[model samples]
Target: MRQYFPSNLKHLCSHYRSISDVCNRLKIHRGQFNRYLAGTSFPTSFNQKRICDFFGVEAHEIALPTDQFLQLISSRTPRPTLAMITAPQRAVEHLRQCSSSRLQDLVGHYHEYAYSISHQGRILCSLVSVKELDGHIVYERVEPSASRSNGSDRTSCYRYEGVAYYLGDRLFLIDYESLATSEINQTILIPSFKTRNARLNGLKMGVTACDHRVPVCSRVVWSSLGTKACGPEAFRKVREYRDDDQELDSDLKARLAKAQIIDGLFRII
Candidate 1:
């Protein structure tokens, strides 16, 4: 038990930045902490509880053999099921299981509009299809073209296909670029279907540049196009809206102005 105790203690301490950091967090003297590490002594019951609480583990950790301890802890962890392997699939599945049935309302086609975070103030627009297939909701976005700044009447087209799901009140769309440009996008949608606001609003974050690339991750606002349109009309709208030569959905415009990115609500990977 003594042999196992010191080895296990060292293993746990190694997780921390340093033995001194762990000792400081434990509020124990450094000398005493080192003695416990050397297997020459052990923590008091009270101190053991403090250590366990700090690490968010049980007090019996010290008695556990290093291997058995790791196995036991790992066994308690929630493992991902097959469906959760992809962010798109996971988002779609989570939305279905979430307490609210509002996810069903989002099933349909929408034209997504947002300003490019990487390109400064330029608008990025695309058409999307969201629907349930078999047992999950899938998201497909098609960006027909990137508008030319010089009004050259020519544009670059692309498509993104992926799965989408919602957590709590927020919806997530994870997509991949068709070419090997290594692009992945995460578009967040907030449900604003109530109170005459038919369009949903959220932020789109992902890789913006391919070669000389902008910052690693860029952020942009995405809102739904109010009414559905056929190919020619939709494509025209996507371009005109880019240069502010066209009108935006009234609800979408209102939502964007009111929305502010909450720093505490976001985290960097």
Candidate 2:
């Protein structure tokens, strides 16, 4: 479907000099906002909401299909596909006990908790130093083409430090870096293994224009497994296996089970 932003936004504030004006108000850069105006890029749902707040407009108005078209550029580059990891049998058995509804609830809760931690404006603008204790896993911040429209499209600018690890059934983010450490205290969602490839090659993570801005990392887990872990509802579904009363359909249950099992073996070293 085609997408667009409201035309009236340009005419609203007389003092607004350029897309830069809007971005400055929004705390984003001029070029990034220009991409949105030109229809060469599309903002993620989170950014779309931020843009709406900046312009004093509704989210729907700022994300009109035609606006997306204006910034649309056709690229024929082929993206990399994520590698499939094997899940543990024990994890599958554990997930089989829960219903779909319960699983949804688990994912939802996790998402809300994570969002609350990240939305507090704590992690923005900081120099983070990264270190891998276990292995040669290098985590570098990159600016992906997908984030070009978000008004902070600078490439690999911010130096945020954090260690990424794989838990039993999820990915965890711990802030050990000096930058924004006091403000950000807790494990946040970096990305799930299922969606790691999309985040790395397609959506781009760890890159932000401003010093204190929260990096825009696409929740690729949702796109990869056809489910989201960014909200309470989705979290419940992923964790539903812990429930005993209801049962999900075989296919969905299998996927969740697999995700859980895979999460156990891949320790981010």
Candidate 3:
């Protein structure tokens, strides 16, 4: 079946500074690229995916109205200005500004309150640090939890390292398990910067209750541990918080179960 590059796709290709450059990157023949640019015909499914990936756009974007496509792409893939790829030191500073967005301005330690995947109404407590050094923003996380499911007793620790940045209104940390599975964790932290218990809420891509795995949404939340520099002494506070523990502050429990940010036992500023 013959198809054509929709108006939106053509517009997206036009926005690029050079058609030849786009063709070279996409590895599409110059004639073929021009055909698509003219909206005379579309590429094969594989080529469509390549083109969309090259543009950092969704495949469905080809069918979207120009305005909607523009809006969607604008938010997800902000136009890379010449300022970002410039060779001079000032240009480098301009690029750094995006990674060091307003949210990343709060870089330090936090009492990560991740919702447990194995048990219901329980929380996993850990320590995480977000730091920006030499214009590179990065985060380190350490989660310690015990699996008591199936009457088994085994303890495990999950450590992750990844890049942290703010996109739109939320802060995101994209990390992978280095020593273990290559599973990618997309953690979205909704910050109420001055709110008492402000922390990054989390979501693991897949829910695995001990060997049993399912594609379900597991609840996760984060609470700021504090911004103070830490040492070996600070590591003692992490624990598994079940709903009934007396040590678990009521406000914190509410925040974990109900996703509320309050200022009681812990506060972030």
- Identify the candidate with maximal TM-score: 3
State each model's CA lDDT, in order. 0.64, 0.34, 0.64
TM-score-based ranking: 3, 1, 2
Deviation from native of the Cα of residue 150 in model 2, angstroms: 64
Q: Candidate 3 deviates by what RMSD?
A: 14.0
What's each prediction's clash count?
A: 2, 46, 2
What does the lDDT come to for candidate 2? Answer: 0.34
Q: Higher-TM-score candidate among 2 and 3?
A: 3
Residues 1-269 of candidate 3: C-alpha lDDT, one tens digit per residue: 12334567667767677878778767789898788767777788899887776666667766676777677767784654332343574444444576435855657787766566666666667777888776667788876756522223554667888776666666767786667764667776666757643655545444564666654444456666577787775565566766687866776666555433356422222
What lDDT, from 0 to 1, does candidate 3 have? 0.64
Please give the distance, in angstroms, between residue 50's alpha carbon in candidate 1 and its true position after superposition.
36
**Candidate 1 accuracy as lDDT:** 0.64
